[model samples]
Each structure stands twice: as C-alpha cells, then as structure tokens.
Target: MKRCAALCAGVGMLAVLAGCSGTPEETPVASSPSTIGTTSAPAPAASVPPAGPLGSAAYQAELTKLEQSLAGPLRTLTRVRTAEGLTEAMTTLADSLDAASSQLADLTVTRRLTAVHEVLQDSLGSAAETLSNSDRTEANARCGGVAYTSQKVQRQLRADLSGATVPLDRLGLKFGGTLPDPGPEPKPVRPSNGAIVIRSGPTGTGRLKITNGTANDVAVSIVTDGKPPAKPHVMMYIQAGKAATISRIGGAYHIYFKSGADWSPTRRQFGEDCSFQKFEQAFGRNESWQVNLEPTLGGNAKTTEVEAY
Candidate 1:
C-alpha cells in the first residue's frame, strides 16, 4: 500500500511541472518598420510673390489728382512780377503744398508705389520749405531769382516722378505755370551835352580841368576813395574836342571815365562803344588837376581799364 501511495505522489508532481512548463498564447503588439537606417523628409515652405500693378491703380489716381490741384497756385505764384507779389504768391504756394501733404498722409498705396508716394511727399515738403526760406531782401532785389527757385523746384519734382511706375497723370502732370516776361528793356537815360549828371559830398577848394581830344563824347566820374569804393563824388560829361572844369571837389578821389554814345543813369554805364578807365593815382582836397582824354605817348599819369562800376 505504501509503495502505491508514493507512486501516485510522484505522478502528481510530474503533472504539475509539465503544466508550469507548457507554452501559452500572447496578444499581438503594433509596430512599424525599422527606423535605424531610415530618415524622414520635411515638407517645403510656402513662398509669396510681390504684388502686381492691379493694386497700384487706385493709389496712382489719387496721386495724379493731388498733382493737378497744385497747378492753379503754381500759376499764380509764377505770374507775379513784383517782390510784394512774389511774397504773397509764395505764401499761397506753401499753403497749397501743406494741404497736399496732409492729403498725401491719408492715402493708402502699395509697397512699390509707397516709394514713389514718399518721394512726392518729400518733394512737396522741400518746395514748401524753399518758398518759406527765401530771402525777402534778395527777392526784392532780383525777382528773377524767385522765378529761378520756383522753376528749379518744379524741375526736381518732375525728375523725381519721372519713373515708369509713377502716376504722372490721367493725362499729364502740371506742376507750375508759365513765368512772366521780365518787362521791356529799361529806356536809357541820356544826359545833355556837358551835363553834370551827379555830384555829391562836401565842397572844397579842389578843381579839375578836363580836355577831350577824342571824337566821341566822354563822361568823367570822380569816385570817392573810401569803404564801398568807386562811388562817384562828381560826374561830368564833356563833348568831343571840348574842355570842361569841375570845381569845388572835396576829399580824396579817383578819376574814372567812359567814352561811349548813350549814358544810362540807372546802370551808371554807357550803352554803346563803352570804354572804362581809371587813373592809378588818387587826388585829395584843395588840389587842382588836369586830365587829357586823348592817349599820349610818355604820359605822366597811368590809366587801366576797369569794370563798369
């Protein structure tokens, strides 16, 4: 009986060991292919192109309109003939430019057109500044200078907007108007024969005896020797082959003479066949001097040709 029990126990132990050693089914796991020797490529980045002219039309129209508005003021400004008129006209032009600049600020333009728009804006400002900064005294002296400045500003603006992309006009751009003609040539003032056209300064015991041996009429100017030199202290005219005396001349002075046909008082110069010369030596008060208009060999006084004073 003990032997059978021992054999049953051994059989049970063998069966348990066999069950523990038996293979069991497992759940399948998801996986990709081996990545050790593989690489992933990223997608390409997107690109955007520059805008074309389709977006530029509206901005161009606005700019063209703005440019046209300046023509009236420019016309008025350029038509002015006097300094006072120029001052008034320049103020008007500057105001117009200011208004244009304000309008420009409200505009919306494309990237390429933005550069052109900024150039226009800058030109307007520059023109306004130029008008504002003009020297009033100089303007009064030379109205032509004012016209020149205006013309220069207009030319620069035109040149700056000359690009193909610029909106010159729906038709064409007009910046300023026609400049007025510098009036008719001033009529020459011809003094009578042997006339003293001008005489100034304190009178003294000095005197001058002038002899004209040439065929043409001669005018002699006693120019004062001082600051702002060449100002005439006494001016006298002598007919051909005539003699004249200038008495009561005062202070130190130089002798200048011009032989010509027509004498212009405003220009202080002769109109035709003008020849200007000045004696090298200076003469003082209370001295009597003699001058010969005819050129002489071995002359005591030296003379040189000088510019029209």
Candidate 2:
C-alpha cells in the first residue's frame, strides 16, 4: 500500500509539473479528495505469458485419462498365472498402450513426453514376446530379456515423474513409488575373434580402471618393476563399452592391452619417476588412475588420455 501511494504521488507531481509548463496562465490544481476522479486514472495491468498448448485443459485431461486407463491393464498384468494368461493380459496391455500412444501422437505435448510413450511401447511389446516363448529350455533367456527391458523402462519413468507422481488409485501402482528395482546389466558377448593380450610392464600400487571403447575384447593388466608393492598385479578383461576396475599397490607402473594379433603398450609409465605437485603428492597413499583403450591402425589398441577425476 505504501509503495502504491508513493507511485501515485510521483505521477501526480509529474502531472503538476507538466501542467505548470503548459501555459503562462494559472491553472486550477485538483489536490483535494473530492477532485480525485479528475486527478488520476487506474494503472494498466501487467501482461501475463501464455502457458502454451501443454497447459491446455484438453491436454491435462488426456494425461488424467491415460493414468486412469492403466488401472485395468495393470491389474491384468500383475495377476497372470500361466503363459496363456500372460498372453491375454499382454493383449489388453498392448491395446491400452496403443491407445495411449495415439492420444499423444500428433499433439505438441508429446515432444517432451516421448520417453514416456517409448517406455510404454517397449514394455508392452517385450511382454508380448516374453509370454510367447514356447521353448522351455529358453525360459531363462525369455525372462531375462523381459526383466532387462522392463526394469530400465520403469526406472526411467520413476525418475521422470520424480517422487510427487500421482498414483493409479485403482491399480495401486504409483508412478515413482511402485517402480521395480534395477536388474543387473547383461554381460556382453565376446566374439570368437576377440582382441588378444599384449605383454604388460612390471606393476605398481594404485587404482587402475580400464575402459574398452574399441570394437574388440581387451585384456589389460597392471605391472610394476620399481618398488616391491604390497598388492600383486591383476589382469582385467573388458569388452567394448564395458569397464573393469582393479586395485594396485602404489608404485611406478605401466599398462598393456592386446587386441587380435597386435600387442600395443601405453607410452607413459604411471606413478614412476614423475612427481605430482606438493599438494597432490601421494602421502603413502595410492593415487587413482584410468586407462581408456581405442582402436589404432590395423588391429592395435592405444590408450587415450581423459580427465576422469
């Protein structure tokens, strides 16, 4: 109220100044409360930004419908007792999924929620495939596949919704609260013709993390030729897009990786004669190190330098 009064006072003073400057003749000033109507007019309103299509009543209603429709499908999916029953449940689920996807397909709101639709589609499609597996011998593979895809999708949905997600009251499945736990990552298959191992230098103590980015299997090992370390060197096998961590006793060391018939070595010996800054100098403690291997010429593997810490 005080601020509004001050603003009005400033406006009135400006008006009085303008009135005085207009003419040499004396002009009657409207200063009394009775003259308030002639003195000032209401201030114009501040403009508000539009909320866009996502904020539309129709879009929010669509979301509510989607959340509600999942109830019957969720109940069916969670109560399957046999493979045939599972198939029937998935048929219903797939239909619900199709309907949900279609609702958002052409809408501008779908752009931000693309991940939600992808998760729904993947879960439905994989569930159908999982239940269609007739080979008893491949039961584990079928179960594993479904578990992997569903777990990842559920986790993503949980993260996307955060904790305040609305729950499906009828189905008892809350978006963020009812997500399944993450399953262990599947092991990568090493091709028959995988990368071979090159000879490693002597080992030393430190932390060694190896990342294989090339399209081959890499056999990495830590070696120390300097001070007799407390921990022995360990060999790590990593596939493409995978990594392995090893503990090394602190000392000067070298890294070696082998791919195919070629044996390549890291150029620098870690923790060897080189010294760190006074503050960074190791105080009877092992410093952390990471080595990333990438494909070089013909078939050799070369280490890449990247800041990992």
TM-score winner: 1
Per-candidate TM-score against the hidden true structure: 0.40, 0.26
Query: Distance from true position, residue 294, model 2, in Å?
Result: 39
- The best candidate in terms of lDDT: 1
lDDT of 2 by residue, 1-309 (tens): 000111111211110000000113322221111111111212111122123334223344554555566566656655555444545555555455444444333334323333343344344334323333423312221222333333433344344434223322222223322233465433444432223222244444456555666565545544454422222144455665676666544454555343331211231111111111111111122545444454333321223332100
- Candidate 1 runs further than 4 Å off: 1-189, 227-230
For candidate 2, the per-residue lDDT at 161 reads 39
Q: Deviation in angstroms for 9 in model 1?
A: 99
Cα RMSD (Å) between model 1 and the true structure? Answer: 44.8
TM-score of 1: 0.40
